[model samples]
Each structure stands twice: as structure tokens, then as C-alpha cells.
Target chain A: MSCNIAIAGVTGAVGQEFLRILEERDFPFSSVKMLASARSHGKKLTFKGREYTVEEMTDKSFDGVDIALFSAGGSRSREFADAVKKAGAVMVDNSSAFRMDPDTPLVVPEVNPEAIKDHKGIIANPNCSTIIALVPIWPLHNANPVKRMVVSTYQAASGAGQAAMDELALQSKDILAGREARCEAFPYQIAFNLFCHNSDLKPNGYNEEEMKMVNETRKIFSCPDIAITCTCVRVPVMRAHSESINLEFDSPITADEVRELLSTAPGVTVLDDRENNRFPMPIDADGKDDVYVGHIRQDESIPDNRGINLWVCGDQIRKGAALNAVQIAERLV
Target chain B: MSCNIAIAGVTGAVGQEFLRILEERDFPFSSVKMLASARSHGKKLTFKGREYTVEEMTDKSFDGVDIALFSAGGSRSREFADAVKKAGAVMVDNSSAFRMDPDTPLVVPEVNPEAIKDHKGIIANPNCSTIIALVPIWPLHNANPVKRMVVSTYQAASGAGQAAMDELALQSKDILAGREARCEAFPYQIAFNLFCHNSDLKPNGYNEEEMKMVNETRKIFSCPDIAITCTCVRVPVMRAHSESINLEFDSPITADEVRELLSTAPGVTVLDDRENNRFPMPIDADGKDDVYVGHIRQDESIPDNRGINLWVCGDQIRKGAALNAVQIAERLV
Candidate 1:
């Protein structure tokens, strides 16, 4: 028996990525449904060489579906998660609405595949930056328990959704042609420019995007005591997210040990070629599934061998969100 | 009498910036001689609305010149610094050649203006990334001795020179038009991509750019014992360099105290507006002399407020190189 799948918000950036990933993996499916908001109704999308017309998502849309991948915003998930559950479908949500709910398991299949078995008809995907960062960290943490983590992210435009990605392209074109780059999806021009994440600021001066990273890592790791601080900045890249991470461990760990651990770890590719001065670039990780890890070195500032630094790049839309959700669905099967 | 100035490599990016900065500051000059490689000998460069023909730099170029500003790469500085000095000219060298020399003072006027008095004949300008990072750091270091510094830089194309900047513009247009981007001046496409600084990788795995930040910072701060580690990456920006700096202090220091100390610090402008999510961006710091400092927050990973993080942006050609060299000239005057 094959699973019957439904893709919510199928016309969006992550939603489109879900369709591509599903086809690339040759996911076993008896039937597929494409659903989106009314604005995208009657839109045509192709899956596995089969064209499917997009349907307006409603309470009854998930009937007879085995798994529904939701990439709609948080409010849409809040409105339809119960309906998907009542229709006997497992909802693998890519929204932030249910991620922090204790009842809903937040899963990254590589880091915590067992969490999928505990889901109560709905599982939440961790934030894109968090998923990309943890794919490398979880393996190292397994080798040596990290006492503290300092992360500074070079995030991409796709995190803000399809409109923002389009804005980057359009603004870049305009600016190159000597026209004033018009800002729409972002508060400022995103072409050849960077900014602090535009998320709402918290009382502690950390933006919401940064806070999500801090909170989501704890939830996925199931370790509430990990000391984490992050600075998230939106850069002008199209899709991939790059992070510079400083990890302080309780015990000393060498760069070679870290490399050996990650070499055997699932969903990680090592690119630490110091001789060639090559490390992970977001362009290299743009459409790849694995987290590109490199620039592994000892933090000289900390004389102890306990502090190590690394650079990571992963496609935010694929591995960070859509592919991760689809991987969780595979685990459920 | 006004100082007679000779600008070496006057046709290059930093050289042009030096001319603009001189005009903007209304610098007192008896005569301005523009000099470059033999290939640029006939090129005309305008300064203060008067066009000056670029001269092929030779040993005689520094004769009758009070201060010679050298920016024509390290080899040229090594070949010409002694001649300029022997010709009774003070060489404000902007190359890496003499920066680490014990007898040649590396000066960031705001951080170490007193060091200028000890310059035997040549005063070396610190690296652009180092200058930008140290402006705000020195004040904080003065307030509380920083035990460690961790720096990650998002550098601009101007650091590479005029050809690289032009390539960024050209590659960007080609990519937007669905054509393949041609890579030159850099090992990879730089229009929409970034890479580790192209400087030769050292035996310690740090690039020349990163080593400059480490070594030059030590010499300028007169704190050779302070621990420092840096990772420098070149982004797609046309000008200006931004750095993410994490400082570990011996004792706990509050974020409020950092803001207060930087508010009065020379060559620093605080842009920390958490409510509005406004912080320093390269676009905001482009063509500006003061290093823009913001994103000031206590790193929560290190409890007790021992770690403070900040972001800085400064015009590389201005404060990082040319303006800094000119400031040394002012000290000579």
C-alpha cells in the first residue's frame, strides 16, 4: 500500500520545493493532492510528470490523505491542523504555529527520527536556520557534549517566502540598471545589501528570528540546559543559509576528531579543504540536501582545546524546511 | 607652507578615494602629485576640480614631497618606502609590507595617534578589516581590558581593487540576464556569491587577511599577549566592510556600559536601535568616516555578562586605508 499525500500551499516557495523533493525521492504515492489559498486556486502544478490542478484549501481538503505537508503560514496551520487530523491524516507542518507545542513533535529526521513516532497526528518542522545549524552540531554533540554555542547566521531571502525572493531578483536588476531598488517584501533594499533580521525584537534585544533559533534548538535537542546565543542577519543570497558556529565543549575535541565524527554522520558533507582555501559557500549549498561543513579549526582565542569553530551552509528551502518535512513523513511510513 | 603630497597608485580604487577624502576634508596642500604604475602614466585624475596627469612612479617622485601616501601593493611599498624616506618625505604606507615591522609604527590615529610621534620615517596603515574592527574595540578595551576577541568579517569588493568591483557589476548583470557569470579577479563568481578572502592561506589555516587582523591588531594595540582569532569572507558589496565581533572580558560588563563607552569614543557612531531594528549596515557606512557600531548585546551563552557582541561597518577606503594614512600625514604636519 502506498501513501496518499497532499501538499498545502503548493504554490509557494517551500511548497514548490516539496513537490520537487517528493518527485526526486520517487516517494511512494497512490494519489497526490495540491492545495493552496483561494488566490492560487485553479493553478496547475506538475508532480512526477503528472499535471495536477491546485485546489483551494478548506476544512474538507485532507479527506483520504495519509500525510499532508503544510507550508502555509502559522494562522493557516492553526486553522486547518485539526481538520487534517480529523480526516485521519498526519500533518507534517512547516509553520511555526505548532512547533513549540509540547504535544506536537518537532522533528529533524537526521537528528531525531524517533521523535516522529511520538507525534499525535501532527509533527512540526524546526525553523530553517535551526535545522541547518543542528544537522552538523547534533553529530558533534553526540561525540562531545557542548557546553555553549555561539552562532551568527548569514541567512538568505527565501526564509521570508517567495515574494521576498522575487524582491531580491527585481531589486538587484533595478539597482544594476541604475534605478532605485524598490523595497517591498523587506524593509530595505535586499540587492547587494544586508541587514539584521527583520523579525520583531524581543525585550532582551534579540530579534524573533534569533530567538527562534535559541528556543528551537533546545526543543529538538531535548536539552533545555544548553547555553545558546545567536545573531541572525539577512544577507542577499537567494536560497541557502550559512552559519558561523563557535562550539565550546566540556571536554577537549580536536578538529580531526570533529571531522571524523561528521564524516560518518548522516546528511553532512565535509568541505574543510584548508590547503585550497575552500570552505562551504551558500552558492555551493544552494540546491543540495546535505549540510556543507567546513572551516573546522581550533578557536585560538580560547587556549583550551575545548573550543572549536566551523562554517555551515545548507539550502534553507530544501533541507531546512521542505525536504526535512518529507523525510519525517517517510519515517512515519 | 602647506604640505606637498604625492599619492602613489593614484588611479586605483583606494587612490581615487584618497583624492575624494582630501577634497572633502579641505586638506591643506602646497602641491598634489598623482602617481601610478607606468601603464597608468598618461591617465588624468581630477582633484578639487583640477585635473592632474598620473605620473609613472619612480625614485624621483618623492623629491620635494613632504608626505608620500603609498597604496600600490606591498612590493611597491617595499621598493619605494626607503627612497621616499631618504628623499626627506614621510611615507604613510598603506601596504602590508611595513605594518608588522617593529620600528615602523602601525597607526590607527584614533586608537594610537601617540604612536605616530615615534614613526622613524614610515608610518604603516593597518589593514582595512583590522582598522574597522579596532575603532570600537579599542575604546571598549580601554574601559575594560578585553581578554579575547573573535571576529568574522563580511568584506566588500573594494578591498580587492577597481577591477574586482567592475567585475561584480558585470557578473551581476550577466547573471540577471540568464547568462553565465564570468569569474576573474576572484576564484569564484562574486556577483551573487561570497568566498573566503582570496589571500593566500597560511600554514596555520588562516588566510593572509585573517592574519593581518590578528597580527596588526596586536602591534597597534600594544597588547601582543591578547588572544585573537578572525575569519574574513568577501561578500558582494561594492564598498565598506562589516564585522561581527565577540569580546570576552576579564570581568562582567553590561551592554548598557558598552553603549555608554562607545557613545563618547572617537571615530565611533552608535546606531544601536533595538526598537526599530536599526543597526549598522555597509550601505549606511559607505563613504562615512566614523565606524558605525551597533547590534550591541550581551552574549547570553556566556552568563554573568562576560561576553558582549557587536556589529561594525566602515568605509574600507576611507577610515580603513586612505583616510587613515592621510591622518598620519596630518600628524606629520
Candidate 2:
């Protein structure tokens, strides 16, 4: 099948990843359009060794576009998503704008690929941390129904954008050189320091980032009855995100069984080498497509082996956002 | 009473911290002896504007010492602890070698100062991460017992040693300057990356650092019935450690009550400002003696209010190690 694609917000971090992934995967496309804001209009973006000038996104930018991948902020997606759909194009949005909407399917292709068929012109991509987490969690839950899941995220600055990544580098240099750290991209220093996720705290006392994990996981897994809680924190890492997850099952399970199951699971890699002290580090997951899982062990606190713990790392830009949306687009054809 | 003190492993990271804390707190001592390995013997160290030479620790080094604070490795403590007691000095050892010994009292002054009276001759300081966690956990457990606890740590390089801290600095510079990070102090690059704690893994699949948090908290709190599990990871931060803790209680508790309880608690500070996103960060806790606790909220995943979540940060060198040992020594006098 021939395809024409448009990448909205093509100059942002995740947008850049969107272009690179398409080129590297040799995605077949009859035409490609790079769309960005007016500030980035006319900016040259090189994809597949060919230069394409970024067009200013507007109501009509999706003309003749078969699929529109949206990674701009939530407001932009909310404003332009309908226009894309009105132009007879499917929109795979990477923003939180429509994720919780009952009509918009919140999809992690690996976890809920069938949900794609139910989408009414727009399929919502899960949050980066949520996408990285559920990719491994869904397989485990399918084997043994998880009664409860607790997640603690070690997120990276790239989740904010390319500007935050630049801030981290600049702050680290200034701090090392005995100067005050610049704090434009973040509220405080992001160099050699860690803080709680800087999202707005809801009335329930959970931050927006944490609640997104709780809400989006329930939607994608189609298991609102599953007990889930998450604590999200930002560490000083550049791109990849890490999570320490604890899962409680309705029935007993063993870590060895978990390793065996994930070994054959798509988009999963096991790196649990206890003797060598080698596990999934963020560096190992950066620039990689697969979610790295390790430190898988039985939670000894629970009786009858009814619980398991794991550490997972994934490239937030790849498996978390742009690549996930692209994977959804791949299924459309 | 005036006392003659000896600091074992004075050349190490925690040992040097011991001296700074002693002077800062104005610990009562008539004279102080600096003891270290033969390689560091005769090295000059200044304490309170007084110069002292580090003596090679031997069987006779504790002769004139009344209270000997040991921050050396486990083997060094085991090799010299008996000698310290034989010389009539009360030994406050900060190594795991004696922490679990039934004969030795494992103590966190804020949590279990009464345990100091049960010491045969040695008082063992709990692990750094354990000490930081139990400071705030004890008060809540006193109000209403904790049935289960799940702890995930964001530890710093200093937990490994001074050399590890140096390696983190050097590696960050190298990576930023477009060079491969040097990996002498750690098995992997610790710049812009994180991994499972480097401590040896036990047969049960828990790393030693994680087991230390579990075993030490059980001993210090004197609550063996509480189910505790921990996952410890090394972040790129330099000195302070952060933790995301989930606590399950026997009865329901409100976040407001927790804030009230911690406000009056000793050596604890509350920083939960939800409006401005000003919860505790590592930089805020660095060089501070208090355990900064915040992000207290109900775990909504539970059907009832039987769960509470918290974020805590504390200087691993100050309250976690050396100051904790000094506080134990203060109780002796």
C-alpha cells in the first residue's frame, strides 16, 4: 500500500526522532511533509539524505496526508487534530490532549494493537513513561493477572523537550566551572540534582505525570480494576527513562518464569546478569528500540511468591513517543 | 565528662565526615586520634584548628581512646573492633560486620536510642540508606504500625567512596567533552547513566545494598513483623540520596496527620509545597543533617486509606553515616 505522511511539530526532540526512525526503518511512503510552527517555518530538515523545508502547521497542512503524527504540546494537538482528521487522515497524537477521551483510543501498539481498529480517526499515544512501562507489564499481566502494580519512575530531562536536554548540558558545565546553573528550561538546577516530576499536582495529591501513568495504563490494558499507583521523579539522565516496578499477582509466579516469558516477547530484552552486576542501565536503553528489563526477582516480602519486582529502561524518544506513533501508523497500512 | 576519641579509617569518605560532624556538633572530647591504613599513615589531618597525624591502625591504637568511631570497611572493623573494646573504649562501628551481630546493638539514635544500653561493648550504626529512611519512618510507625514498606533509592556516588565521587566528576567531564568516560572507580560509566547498585548480589537475588536497607531497618526498628522490600539504584548525583517510599499501614492515616507528626519530630524537615512544586530535592538536602521529607499523600490505589507515599532526601555522608555515628557516641556520654 502506498502512504503519504505529515509530521506535525517536526523540529522538536520527539519530532526529530520521528524522522530518523522512519528513514532507518525504510518506511515506504509516496510523500512526506514536515510541519512545524511559524517560528520554525522554512527551517531545513534533512531526512533520507534529502533536505525538506519545514512548513508552518495550519488548518490545511494535512491536505492529502494519509497519516499525521502529532508531538506538539497538548493545545496544538487539540486545535489541529480535528483538522487532520477532517482532511481524511488518521492522527496518531503523542500528546495528553485526547488520551483519556473515551472516543479516542489510547494505544500502545504492543499492548493493545487491536484497540487501533476502534479508533475514530485519532489514536492517542500513551505518555512516554507509561509507554515504556506497559510494554513489559502487559505480557506479564497476561501470563498472571496482576492484582496490584506500583511504579517509581527515574525519568530523563528529554521528556520536557530538546531545550531541557540542552539545559542539562549547559547547567552541568556551568556548575563544574564554578558558575551558577542557568534555569530556563527547568525551574531549578538539573545538573547533579534530582527533583520530583515538575507537573501540576492534582487535588488527589498525585502529580499529573503520576496520574497519567495510572490513568493511561488502565485505559490501554482495559483493566480499570487493576490497582496501580506511580511515583514519578526526574533524574539527571539525558534521554532514556528507568523504572523500578513492583507487581502483585492474583496467583503465585517466579522470576525465572518471568525471564523465560519476556525472552520471547516482542520489543523486550532481558539483561539480568546478577553475578556480573550488569543490569539494564539507561545508557543501554538509549537509542535502542527495545525496552530493556532486568533485576527481575521474586518480592520476598509476599508469601507464596505472589509478587515480583523488576527494573526496566527504555529510550523515551524511541519506544516511548515518536516510534510508538510510527508503529501505530505502520499498522494502518 | 571529658573523653579521648579515636577515629578509625580517618582517610576515607565517611571517616572524614566523622571529624567534621564532631567539630560542628562540638562533641565533647579532650583529645582525638586519627587512625588509618598503613598507606595513609602519617598523613596530616586538621581537626578544629589542631593538626594531628594519622596513625597506622594496629592492635594497640585504641589504648588511650575512650570512644572509637569506626567508618572503615567491614573487614577492618572486624579486625579491630575487639581490640577497641579490649582497650576499654566503647566502639561505634559504622560497618555491616557488626550491625547484625546479636551481641552488638544496632542503633539509629533517632529511632532506637534505648538500644544503646544493650550494647555488649560495640554499638553498630545502621546502613546509610537505612539510617536516612528510618528517621522519619519511626515516628509514623510509633503512631500506627506499618504493615509493609516498599523502598526504592536514588543513591549517590559517595555511597561507594571518595574515589567513586571523583570518578563521577571525571566521567561527566569526559563524556561532555566528546570522550569516552573513564571507568576506574566503577565497573560502568556513571556519567549521564544509572544502574543497579554495584554491591554483590545475594543468592536470594537481592543486592547487598538492598539487603542492608531491609535487615538494618528490621534491627533498628525492632519490628521484625513488618514486611520490607527495597530496590537500590545508583544515580549520577554526588552526595545526597533520595528515596520514593510506599508504606502500608494497619489503619488509615491522612497526609495532614503525617505532616503534623513530622513537623514536631526531631531531625526531620517537611518540604511538601504542592502549589509551587517545591518538594524535597537532593541539592536541598546536601550538607544538611536533617532528613528532608515531603510528597506525603494517600495511595489511592488501595481501597481504603491504608497506604501513604513519601519522597525523602538526605545527605548520605552527614545524617546517613558520620553524623549518625556521632549521635550514637553522644548518647554514650
> Which candidate should be chosen as best, given lDDT against the real structure?
2
Off by over 4 Å in 2: none
Q: Candidate 1 falls in which docking quality class?
A: medium
Separate DockQ for every predicted complex: 0.69, 0.83
lDDT of 1 at B280: 93
lDDT of 1 by residue, B143-180 (tens): 89988888888889989998998998898889889999
B316: Cα error in model 1, Å: 1.4
lDDT of 1 by residue, A26-65 (tens): 8888999999999989988877887899999999999999
lDDT of 2 at B125: 88
Cα lDDT of model 2 by residue, B1-333, tens digit: 879999999999999999989999999999899999999988999999989999999999999889999988999999997898899999999888998888999998888899999887899988889988989989999999998999999999999899999998888888889999979888998989999999999998899999998888888888877798899999999999999999998899989999899999899999999989889999999999999999998998776798899999999999989999999999998
Error of 1 at B285 (Å): 0.9
Enumerate residue pairs that collide in model 1.
none
